[model samples]
Target: MERLNAFDIRELERLCPGGVKENVSLAAISRWQIGGTADVIVEPSSVAELCSLRAFIAQEGLPSVVIGDTSNLLFSDEGLRAVCIRLGSRMSSVHIENDIVHAQAGVWVPFLARKIMSAGLTGAEHTCGIPGTLGGLICMNGGSQRKGVGSSVVTVESVDTAGNICHRSVEQCEFSYRSSVYQNNSEVIASAKLSFLSGDKLKIRQEMLSILAERNRKFPRKLPNCGSVFKSNPAMYEKAGPPGAIIESLGFKGACCGGAQVSPHHANFIVNTGVARARDVLTLVSKISRCVLESVGHHIEPEFKFVSVHGEIMPVDEMLKGFFYE
Candidate 1:
């Protein structure tokens, strides 16, 4: 690990009163339960702390990345040199104001959905079963049943790369199927406002339960995994059916590589059965992608982001190395 300069250490201390944890295990934080360690992992207690930390990193010329729950992320075993800025628990708050719900980025998605439903508000029911932070959902444009969170998003507040706060309306966000303006932009989402319709408590609860039950039935609760591996490409789905269906049809379900395997219930899900590595997950993903392309002529793109040991973004092919090795 590279040593932090005295100035950098002082800056980190000044910005995040609580000193950052060095060489924090990435496996412990990510859903995949795989990867090496982050050189520096800082949990900022408040928005101001986050802003200050960003400034410190910039001034120190250190690489940094902001992450939420690490649900849909794959990190290399070689570890990371970047300072990972995770929003502290203090940011996980959800508040209701009439028909709108304001949620901090660190708030869990399922919890946020429950809060909205408890307030007798509808439209968040589809998110009842998703696992991720509200900020991650917004960044990924997360959705189910053809309705995305962005559809209900009225406004978004984020911090740009320069630590400047920017507020944008739904119209300005440029939301697509499973992506938003935030996907490529180096902005960090702080909070969002979602609009909902008034509904009966019983009706909303029932809807939430139905979605939850469906997800539970399809995804195994015991295994650790990112919810879905590939984005649903409607065009590809129309031409060759869904990615899951194609992979399952090719007899890839229950396929195992190291500790990672494609779920028997849902081929789209690659599970970590106790001790899987990031390499194992990427290998499984590559095999599935190859099989899907050969069988259905569709190249399924992965939904997760791959971070390398050096804090550099990993290429899809490099991340999938050793996937075909027996």
Candidate 2:
């Protein structure tokens, strides 16, 4: 609370009105259900309010972090000492005009996929079961079946650190396997304009159902966990197969550290057995990385982002560079 003075909270309340909250539980917001409290949480109802809040934070030099659905984030056990700006239900809006779709950052991926499918759009069939928001999905260029959302991205709108809205074409996004320019920048995504091919609704629905069925058969849905713990490297896949298969070959399935366990169903997922801590998850990540490196001469990157107490977000593997040697 030392970082956020009473005056700051009052000002934030005035800016965002009913969207501001104090001492909110991060565990309740995170997919892993494993974080401590945050001093302040703000959900801007409109792009205008978000711009104002961003400007104020920049002007006052306040520590702040923006999150979408929190589906791929692992927050610290120690409470965050910054303002948490969550783009969620308030900002989740979708509009479609012919084959073009405009969606806000907070629209859930699954819901967005259904909307697109209903509109008879073809490109979003792969995102039908992703448990995240459009902001995070585009930030990570995420999709299943080796297809990325970047394929349909026509333009992206984001708010810079200075609160200026910026628009960029798909090329400027620098989309790659499980990454985008947003991952390395300070800008927060506001919305996106995407183009899709016209398709038969029945065919699209069948494709989405197939993908969902395969996911359900392979993934652990009964437990609380981030979707994937390791990024799938194309080169590594050719050399050693996918991360899940490799981790399973190394006997890591059902492995446990504190209350965190390597999912018995999917080797790439680390699940919370009711009570888990950030340290436990990181320990498992470090152990998995060490094993992978020792066995395959490949350093697998993590797909999940870890948010520290200071609001700094980094990949678990990057944070554990020294852990490899120790």
Candidate 3:
């Protein structure tokens, strides 16, 4: 991995112009609010700008990563040391044409859900409370109520590491339960066109509101935390229970390791108590994984992705493999 510096920042500025920022706080951008400063951050306002910047990065053989909202990610205490390309508010745009929706990668999932609902769309109600961007949701096939956003996807557009644009249909996306082909590739999701069905606007609004209220009542709201810590496996659910229920049954609810604690409201969530470090969260995760595997004879996998200081990202469970309870 290549480390960015003042010289690299200047070159990046020339490549993308006004979309460059330096020495940004990772904690400020991350939902968990618990990381050190990032050396450089770039927010491309358009696909052209993103392509130019990405091409420059590839030409220079520099370390780079793409992120949106940071809702399900955890960064190291040492922070990110590469060029962080953030697709966010500047790139957010949602266009509705009848039952079809064209949404940019940065469009917030909840906001997009509401937009679809207001347009009499029914398939998006399940996403009304997910706190990630459209790109992240698509990559993870994320949604509440066991319904995935991938189900509504018609076509997806992405930019590869070499700055080449690619398009794929829903079938080509290879979406499964909480998984997608993007998880196995280096492609950056740019935008997507989703298909929906017509419904009563009033009925859609009521359902979305009801889902939001239930989420608000069930999840912790006062602290900084990523949504769910563990992914619920279908086999585990049938044999034992959901991740939250299984964790709670093991007396791990409210369990704390330093400043990080398993949320009392939802045992599957690990909340930062004002001063939690990345290490603290990892400790609690290891404890949970080890205890569950030993007690219930099943391994619970993490839903969160861990971002290392070197800008390498991987599933938290994979990173902790063979090192649990250390």
Candidate 4:
């Protein structure tokens, strides 16, 4: 990784033209509201601008990270060393052509789902109330009620690690559970085309509203949380039921580590009660994982990516090491 200086902003301005914000608080952008600062936060207005920005970062040897909506992510309290790129609001348009819906990566999943429903399209109603952008949804293969977004995806257009634009169809995406091939590929999703069935607008709206109501009832709004913290492996829960049930049975509900607590409304969610640090959340998560493993002989994997410890962003490889090793 390389260090960035004031001079780099001049080059970034030339590449993006819209300018970038320096030393912006990551907490403002993240759902948890607990991250430190991002050295530079660039909101590129167009695909060309994004490409130019990537090229400039590579040429200048500046460390960079691209994030969308920041729903399933945890940033360090120490802060991030890399330049963070966020797609501009101008890139969030959703277009409907016949039965195909084309959505920009920056468009929120709920927004897109509403657009689809208003257009009398089905299949997307299940995504109602899901936080994050369309790109993050597809990248994470986000699902609800046993159905995932990948099932409706037809194609995706993204910028590869080398700054080359590429198109991948659903066949090439390799989506499973809460992950996709793009998870480790360093590719940034720009847009996606989804195929949906033509349906009654009134019925679609009703169904979507019902789903949202159910989600609100189950996950409530009393505390700040990133939905489910761990992925449920069926094999791990054969004797203990689902991960949530296992956690609930272990007397972990309302379990607190510092300011982080297991949400009483839902056992799977670890909420930031108030003034919670990244380490506090991690400590609680570790305690839950250990308790589950010790009591049920099963290790539950985390769904969200942990970006840092105290104030430092852990390397991606190092962050993933424990899951595979122990």
C-alpha root-mean-square deviation, each candidate = 2.1, 1.4, 1.3, 2.9
Which portions of model 2 miss their true places by more than 4 Å? 323-326
Cα error, residue 65 of model 2, in Å, equals 0.7
Task: For residues 232-276, write the lDDT of model 1, one tens digit per residue.
Answer: 788898987877888888999999999899998799888989788
Highest-lDDT candidate: 2
Candidate 1 residue runs with Cα over 4 Å from true position: 312-326
Question: What C-alpha lDDT, on a 0 to 100 scale, does residue 153 get in candidate 3?
Answer: 97
**Alpha carbon lDDT of each predicted model:** 0.82, 0.91, 0.89, 0.80
Predicted candidate 3 versus true structure: per-residue lDDT over 1-326, tens digit per residue: 55676687888888777888878888887999989988888988888888888888899888888889899899989988878988888888999999999999999988999899888989999999999999999999999998999999999999888888899999999999889999878788999999999999999999989998999999999999999999988888899999999999999999998889999999999999888889899989999988999988898999989988877888898778665443
lDDT by residue for model 2 over 155-188, one digit each (tens)?
9999988889999999999999888999989888
Looking at candidate 1, what is the lDDT of residue 116? Answer: 93
TM-score of candidate 4 to 2 decimals: 0.93
**Candidate 4 residue pairs in backbone clash:** 78-310, 78-311
Q: Please give the clash total of every predicted structure, in order.
A: 1, 0, 0, 2
As for TM-score, the candidate ahead, 1 or 2, is 2
Ranking the candidates on lDDT from highest down gives 2, 3, 1, 4
Give Cα distance to truth, residue 20, candidate 2, Å. Answer: 0.8
For model 4, the run of ten residues with the poorest summed lDDT: 309-318
